[model samples]
Target: MKNYHTHTKRCYHAIDNEEEYVKAAIQSGYTELGFSDHTPWHYDSSFHSTMRMEEDKLDGYVNTLLKLREKYKNQISIKIGLECEYFPKYMDWLKQMLHDYPIDYIILGNHYDDTDETGIYFGRPLTKQQLTKYVDNCIKAIETGLYSYVAHPDLAYYDTDDEFYLQQMRRLCETAKKHHMPLEFNLLGYKTHRQYPNETFFRLAKTVGNKIIIGTDAHESDALLDMKTYHLAKQYIERLGLELTEEIHFLR
Candidate 1:
């Protein structure tokens, strides 16, 4: 499968060079690959580290990927993009950046709530109310008509229990269906051995019947080498009876 949310070492939490990732993609039998390293937010935020690629490096990142795209045009289709964390608090500037950059695609990674407040991936623990707001912001981000696909839609439940987070997941799946937006099913969750969105969310999505977009959420070159989790997730998806598609749309 094509990994649409691949990352590079340039992103502080990730570790791997672009070339190494390209080589891995070829070896993994992928036909298409998307390099969507985390885009540094314009403002300081608690969800991510400040050590990510600087503004000046954006061009180099683009140029390097363009060169690779050329080199692997025949072997694999490569697309360079960014996984943007949406913040309605900074909508004006956020919209400006989206227009300014020649980004081929955008992945909505809702790393924070509407108030620019809290998150589960970071040190901040969110309340049930906060979780609701975070999911709302993610849905709003998709409604804005900017992103190609929503990355980790179930991530909002990172801090909550399955029983408490179930309704929220249902609402999230409902929103995805309303907007015709796809929720990324990340395999890294299984690799890291986290409860992840929990099978509860996946089962709910199945009952509600929302579109599933498969993504490895690979932060490094060997990220996809974890074949066990991929197969397990595939089995889960098959059990749920949801169709996974490859037609990357929205911005195209």
Candidate 2:
């Protein structure tokens, strides 16, 4: 199996060293493993958080992963990437980082909207305007053709109005279908019992024919290929009759 959304301790919220994750992937029978730790942003200092690694640590992150890739080349295919929230202001920076680093891909994880001026985390309650803006940003990010897939597309997690949720979600799925961008059915959501893998979102995606990929979104070593989580995702796919893709293709 292949998983492209693993994380590293560099992202403070996660635990364990990078190598531990690699070993876990091997033990879990993953043929292809990707390290897509939460991306470090070049945002203004005032907007910084402990959510990601520091900008200076990017080189080390890449170098360490490259070394592991070579070391484990005979055992598994290793890819290096970053999971990032799309902020238009940092698009240029992202482009340059991709060019400068040996990164293979980026997954758009729209966990936050608004801006340094007034941003709101997705985990908290959102205003109607914020929800609309979240969907708009997701669309704009996909249009950039820079991300491999939109990770946790159901992360908007709105339960206010069924009609509004369906409308916005359908729009996102339709856009992804048009661009041939796959949407990730995140396993972390199932493991954490978070709002994602929302039945309504995937049901609509199935109707719209949006491609799907299962992401472990592994924040800790043990989460790399948790069979229980994998089974849960598999059941969801089977139940929804969703089309699942094994790999991601970068637009660039």
Candidate 3:
């Protein structure tokens, strides 16, 4: 099995070093494990982010992972990547970052609207307008071709079963299908009983024919050692008859 949404302590919110997560993935029998720690963006403002690594630490993050990739080459494939938000103002900087670093891939986290510098968190149960805005931002992000897949595709946490919610999600799923972007079945949310990995969204994804990819979204090292959630998530996806993709397009 392969999982791309892994994290490291450099992000400040996760636990352990990159190697510990790598060992855990090997222990869990994952053929490939990607370290997509929350990435630091070059903010035009002095907006210090406590959730991701610092922009200055970007090189260190890449270099360390490169070494680990070589060290664990025979055990499991290690991909060096980042989980990034699509802050439009910093897109050029992010593009430059992609060019400067040997980043293998990036996944769209969409943690905040606009930029986390001054935006609402997407996890909260959103207003109809906020949810629609979230969908719009996701469509824009998908169109960029920078992100490999949409992690936590159903992140906007809109709780009721209403036509407006369905309409927004339908458009989101359709756009993803058109772009060939697989929406992630976030294992973190499922295992934690979070609002995401929402059944309604996946049902819409299934109907819209969007491909699904399972993401561990591992914040802790041992999160990878346990494969029960992965197995259960697999069974859940299989039972839904939604197509699950094991491979993704690397950024090269």
Candidate 4:
């Protein structure tokens, strides 16, 4: 199987080194694996977070992954990528990063809104206006055509009104369909008993015919494809009859 949304210890919240994750992928019987650690941002304004690697570490991250890619070329296909949140203020910097680095792809994981100066984390309850803004930002990111897929498209949901939730979610799905970007059914959320893979959202996605992809969203090495978790995700997909996109074209 293939999984693009993986992480490394460089993102402080995750565990283990990159090579350990590679070994885990091989042991898990994966033919293709990607390392999409939380991306480092170079914002003009002061922005600090322990969740991602620092800007200076970006080169080291890419070099290490490229080395591993060549070393494991015959064993498994290794791809280097990043899982990023879109802030329009840093969009140009992100594009420059891609051009300067050997990044194969990027996945838009919108975890916050506004800017580094003032942002709203998705974990908290959001007003309808805030929710609409989140969806608009996601659509804007997709329209940039810089991301391979939209990861955890349902993550923006909090305690918003059911009607408003459905309305905004449908809009997100329709925009993804328009851009031909797949929406990730994140396995990490399922494993952790988190909010995503939300029934209402996926049902809307199914109705709108949005392409689906399964992302391990692996923060730790063992999470690559733990058999039980893998089966649970597979069953969820099968039961929903969602159309799964197995491969993606990297940015050239």
Candidate 5:
């Protein structure tokens, strides 16, 4: 119930404000809420490839959240976090950023597997070979001892069949299990795609028996505190007999 990957408008695609998100969390009866905006990757001035809080606004963003945390002390607990996109080259800098800043936690969001030849993404697809490499990089990122959780391990499943994608997801599950890292069952994709976990990915995740954590991945005030898709997905997970770990606690 601790929504760990909520976003704000500075990310360019979100539609919520910090105060609105906090109020929504309280209204939904959550005790804790963490705002994790997408961290900026080093890209050569390309809007499509890189989405983040501009360097100039970074201080304001962090300070505003810090102030909100104090303001909402009695109402709820707020944590400042980052849903970092994976880029191995920036690992050191990312580490310093988190250490130097007042960040509470970090989560992995493997939006891009690698930097393209152009030093920026340009509609490249994930190959089986590339998927394996990318996942390994993500695991290494986890080994860096920075991330608290990982979001959407099956993100590159658009091109493959169930069996093929399941194999990919299993690698992530195995890695997470080995590292004791938690996997987030994101709900935003369900709202847009109209199928939770994209079918192949969810079925495979359930079969593999990885420790699961529900994440709404909300970018709006309403969804920041929502449990609709999460509840629906949990129902399906129950029907499938996937084991929910004893630590599956809801914030709301």
Candidate 6:
């Protein structure tokens, strides 16, 4: 098995070092593992983000993972990546980082609006206008060919009974299918019973013929050791009739 949605302590919200995760992946019988800790943006304003790593930590994040990728080459394949948000004003800086770093891949988190500096978190209930903007923003990000997949693609918590919810997410799913970007059925959400990785969204995505990928979303090293949850999620998605994938595009 392979997982590409792992995180590291450098992101502030995650725990342990990169090595711990690598070791845990090996113990969990995974053939490949990726570290996609939350990325730091070069904010023009003095605003700081509490969830991601600092801008200066970017080099260390990549370098440390590169060394581990080499060290563990005999045992498990390691990928160096970041869980990034598509902030329009900061795309230039993000592009520079992608070009400068040996980043294997990145996944779109889409946690906030144009910028987290706006304090508009997408996880919360959003207004109709905000939802429309959110879907459009995600579509634009997918079109960039920068992100490997959409992590927790059903993150926005809209009331499922509303037809508007289905319409907006269908648009997002169709775009993902068009771009060949798999939507992640995040294991972290499954283990924690988070509202996301929602069945309704996946059903809609299946109707759009979007492919599904399972992401460990491991905030802690031990999270990788949970084989039961992983298999359960695997069976769940497979039974949904959604095509499952383990491959992700590299940042070539």
lDDT of 2 by residue, 59-156 (tens): 99999999999999999999999998887887888889999998899999998884433577775666677778888999999999888999999888
Over the stretch 59-146, how does candidate 3's per-residue lDDT look in tens digits? 8999999999999999999998899998988899899999989999999998899999899999998998999889999999999999
Q: After superposition, which runs of candidate 4 have C-alpha atoms over 4 Å from their true positions? A: none
How many residue pairs clash in model 5? 1
Ranking by lDDT: 6, 3, 4, 2, 1, 5
Worst 10 residues of 1 by lDDT: 115-124
**What is candidate 1's lDDT per residue for 1-252, written digit by digit as tens?**
677888898877788888889999898888988988887665555453554576667778888898999998999989877888777767777677667766678888777554334434421466777777777777788788777887877676444455667776677788787877788887777667655645667777888888888788888788867666777887878777887876676353
Candidate 2 ranges with C-alpha deviation above 4 Å: 114-117
- Overall lDDT per candidate, in order of appearance: 0.75, 0.86, 0.91, 0.88, 0.70, 0.92
Residue pairs whose backbone atoms clash in candidate 1: none
TM-scores for every candidate against the unseen true structure: 0.88, 0.95, 0.98, 0.97, 0.85, 0.98
Candidate 4 scores a C-alpha RMSD against the true structure in Å of 1.2
Worst 10 residues of 2 by lDDT: 114-123
**Who is ahead in lDDT, 3 or 5?**
3
Clashes of each: 0, 0, 0, 0, 1, 0
Clash tally for model 4: 0
TM-score of 3: 0.98
* 2 versus 5: better lDDT goes to: 2
Worst 10 residues of 4 by lDDT: 114-123
Of models 2 and 6, which has the larger TM-score? Answer: 6
Native-to-model Cα distance after best TM-score fit, residue 61 in candidate 1, in Å: 1.4
Candidates 5 and 6, the one with greater lDDT: 6
What would you estimate as the lDDT of candidate 2? 0.86
* Per-residue accuracy of model 4 over 111-174 as CA lDDT, tens digit each: 8895644788865677888889889999899899999999898887565348879888888899
